[model samples]
Target: MKLESYVKLTFLSLSLFLLIACTSEEASKNKTEEPTKQSQTEKKKENQTSLKENIPNAPTNTDELIQYPGGKNAGKSIGILPEDEKKQVHKDLDEFPKITEDASETEKELYWNNLLYLFQEDYIDPQTVLEKWKMESFGSPDIEDPRFQFKENLNVEILLDASGSMNGKIGGKTKMELAKDSITEFSSSLPEGANVALRVYGHKGSGSDQDKQLSCESSEVVYAMENYEENNFEEALNKFNPSGWTPITLALNEAKEDMAEYNGDQNTNIIFLVSDGINTCGGDPVAVAKSLADSNIKPIVTVIGFDVDAKGQEQLRNVADASAGIYANVNDQKGLSEQFKSAQDIAEKWDRWKRDSLSDLDAIKVDRNFMILAFSNDWGRKRDKQNSNLISASDYLYYEKKMITKEMYNYLSDKRDEQKYLTDRSQEEVVSYLESINDKTYGEMKKSIEEKYKQK
Candidate 1:
């Protein structure tokens, strides 16, 4: 009986040992597989974090907005892309990201910046902005006379008012002193072969009413109409002083007689009247000025009011208007000098007109070429800037932010290329039009270009 009991106990112990071994092996297998699963989960989270860190957040402040380098908006912040371009982009792209209410600020800004890749400004026509070429001429160059071809005799008459008011000071110099200096400088600078005359009015008597008749009849040609000679012209300017009443009417009448030989049909006459006041003596200067302008000597009367009163300026302006001329007011020496400089420019142009017509034509060609080059370069720079901005946005959206799929990014690139192609075609058309008329006569070119491009 004892032997049978021992056998039963040993069998039970073996069965229990087998059950404990199976449980321990199963637990160890599960522990080993769990670490592998945990490692995969950790790696996925790390990859996602790295992607978010790769791109910086979009700007929130206006100062951080991207700038444009060229175009009408140069030196300004980039604005929202136009609705037309946005619509076109939307048409080509599928599954475009939406800015939901819950979207982060960075995400919203990123979407807006990406659309700037398609931003384009309206094309500006060069003809609407560029100035037409103006050719300076003396009388008409097409005249048959040889004298008119190279030089149309130019007569410049300087009518000086030596009224008592001319003694007033401006910029530490008397009005008469400033006038003499500016007149001397202007006369010295005149083109050779041009005639100049200096006529002084109201220099013979005092401003007193008792001497009004003598002052009114005092207009005299100090320097007869003749080619400018430095020593002789200086003597002429020194012959007068500020001492009398104004006789503007008498001066205009005498100027007509002084330039009677030089008719408008053969010469260009210009009169520069320097005055400190209106005609104090009883006479209608505006009527006389009109008569002088209508005479054989068609003079272009330019009046300079030197510190004149409002009433005096109005009277002088009326005289100039009646004579189909201009009136300028000057209160200082510098202002006076600038007025004379304008006349000097006209004289220089006359000097240039005396040169060979071929040289003048060459100058016109050079000016036109410069204009064309400037326009072409401007167009090219705007195109390059536009393309550069588009590509830069595309790179940021696709490579850095991963905001756009590769296919969508490529489609944007194609749109940029298409835009560039269209601009290039337009630029080519403008250049061709300009070059087509390059060889045309100055008159023809001026007329055609002005007719085409004048402000609407």
Candidate 2:
């Protein structure tokens, strides 16, 4: 019985040893799996990091594939181009065509990306060819200047002087008849969307206010585009004739009142004053001019003087000057008609009276526009001062003279806005100036300027 017990104990020990060996092998397998999974995770992390770093740098390699913004340098710096341009560049790059499977990867990629960037909205990289195009046809980037174009339609007021002189012959017809004929032509010549008015004076008489002063006036916005008739323009002109003395100031004032209610998108209000003379009946012409100079209802004063004497000349000049307009001196009655016709043609062809204004100082280059010292109204009063356009030393030794004024100082201010023709001088100043300057004609003042500039 003792021998049998010993053999059983030996078998028990062997079974325990085999079980421990199997457990050791299982642990080893688990240890090996942990390292293998760890290696895979590390590799994945490295790949993501590399991608993140490379995002800002475009690939130089031809074989490598990448996306770029359209209308831009994919591999280079982008500039000034807007969003759509960026996408276009990218699209063209994507569309670089492939000829065959064996084609070089660089060539194929280039072909595909180029076409893609050209057409696709989302494309980022653009090819070399697409970069050359520009948007100059769209005009200036400054849209403000272009938008100020006169509206398509216009409204015109032909304010004519039907004084006794209009009865005299011109252009094989009386000045009055010739003016009517031209007015008729202008009415007929206007575009489809034009509103025209005819205001005439001297239709009354020398003895009557309607004739010599203000009452003889008549007005009609005959072919108002709002109520257009092809022949209606001609019919309106049939009712004008010669009447009384030239009351220009009264006519203009009345015109402002007449046009008060007629508002439109385009502020095209014109006063075509055709007359033989200036203010003959009543009212102050210069004061009238001063009144209209800076007003919002500013009419473009185009004066045509028909056989106008010195008085006629002075009257027409004042009217034109005050309104910021052009004056034509026609010697003959026929010339008057032709001038009117020319004016009509000009009005028809150009939306604006002139391409740019004569007052546009820009047309006269600042460098050559003025001999500053001579133009000044103040000189040799308090001190003898001289100035060159550009300031420098030792020039005062030359002892030249210069005139200066408040207007001059304002003009030379560095920050003055260049877009406008004139400053916002007060109307009171203008009115006062007009009232005070009756004894001083431009010619007389100019003639005595040199003598007055010297200190007494």
Candidate 3:
């Protein structure tokens, strides 16, 4: 649950895209035969086109059938992790920041690997340093049981902004419509036994009577954390008839209380917060975020901004970062659907870290000896929240532990996505970004972590 280094590698993905798009070399090559897919630009353009069309492919329309009965049914996982993966494995948390004087050479490697791995840079080649670390590495969640791989279960909580603003179009479709479709896809991807929940705000129908009006502050518990029907998530989306302003802070607190009903650790809970405006029911979101952090619930709260102003996006950003989660600006259904795609590697690693940290026999004891790993999106604090739904979830998993199914394989990603926007390293941007940090010996960054993470 501690904050480590920022994984501040200068990602040149955008520059890389530009470089490929406007490659000086292209002019000399061919004014010729429709460039083949071999050309990166041609390929990327095609992919982007496909991505745009598929964005609305999820359950955006009310008439579309939700393929999965409930959120827990199986489907082909959408995102696939890259084959290369790098991890910092450690014996335990106590080994962080190795105090050299207190440890010998052999122990330092394990602790260093674990500390750095806690916040490993996605761009680094995990396979490159095998010899340096002299340890075997596991890239991602191995598909052991296709039907029931040993991934840590995530109790998903979806917080939808059913405000009028959401009714607006982003990427050519209503944001609310997009969210519901994406949720349907997201839920279908989960392993059958995974727990889930849904909380929709501003869903009360509007009417002249004050009591009848569904305000932005209105939050409905459409589902608790458990296996659900496909219609369950869609029904909530259908209610997003646009009647109010956003109440993000109130929504989170409501979710926190609802999640408290579960008996499991907060680590199992995941919150997807979708919004489109500044708090109409204004309250201090920062304070609420700090509360979640303090509770050790380590919930991964991903905030999606839809067709909103810069200020609205910033507010959501702060809440997400403070809560140990991710902030994504998704204007259309496609962007929203891909939120999981962007964080796929982290999700897989999270499951693996949990599996590796504790043997199946140990789920009962809540072993203090094992420390948890976290990603920028997978903040460590949200994992501490107590949940009531996980009791049956754990039992269901224990009893139905089947081999991973095709459905499960699609879910596990071993590493970061290959095309995820890392600027293709324009030397200028990389150098400039590196220099601004006072390029003061990175050795300091290295030294601080070693000393702090070292074990007794």
Among these predictions, the greatest TM-score belongs to 1
Off by over 4 Å in 3: 1-152, 205-216, 261-266, 342-428, 431-456
User: Which candidate order results from sorting by TM-score in descending order?
Assistant: 1, 3, 2
Model 3 TM-score on a 0 to 1 scale: 0.45
User: On residues 356-453, what C-alpha lDDT tens digit does candidate 1 reach at each position?
Assistant: 33345565567667667766775676667566656755665577556565656666676567667767876787677777877776456546655754
lDDT of 3: 0.45
**Which lDDT tens digits does candidate 2 get at residues 152-236?**
4455777777666677653345767767766665666665555677676655555354443344343333333332354665665
Answer with 1 or 3, whichever has the higher TM-score. 1
Predicted structure with the largest lDDT when compared to the true one: 1
Q: How far in Å is the alpha carbon of 425 misplaced in model 2?
A: 41
Q: For model 1, where is the 10-residue window of minimal lDDT?
A: 62-71
What tens-digit string does per-residue lDDT give for candidate 3 at 310-405? 467568768876775666654446556767543342344445566565233233112111111111122111111101112212222223443222
What are the root-mean-square deviations of the candidates from the true structure over C-alphas? 23.7, 31.2, 27.2
Q: Against the true structure, what is each candidate's TM-score?
A: 0.49, 0.41, 0.45
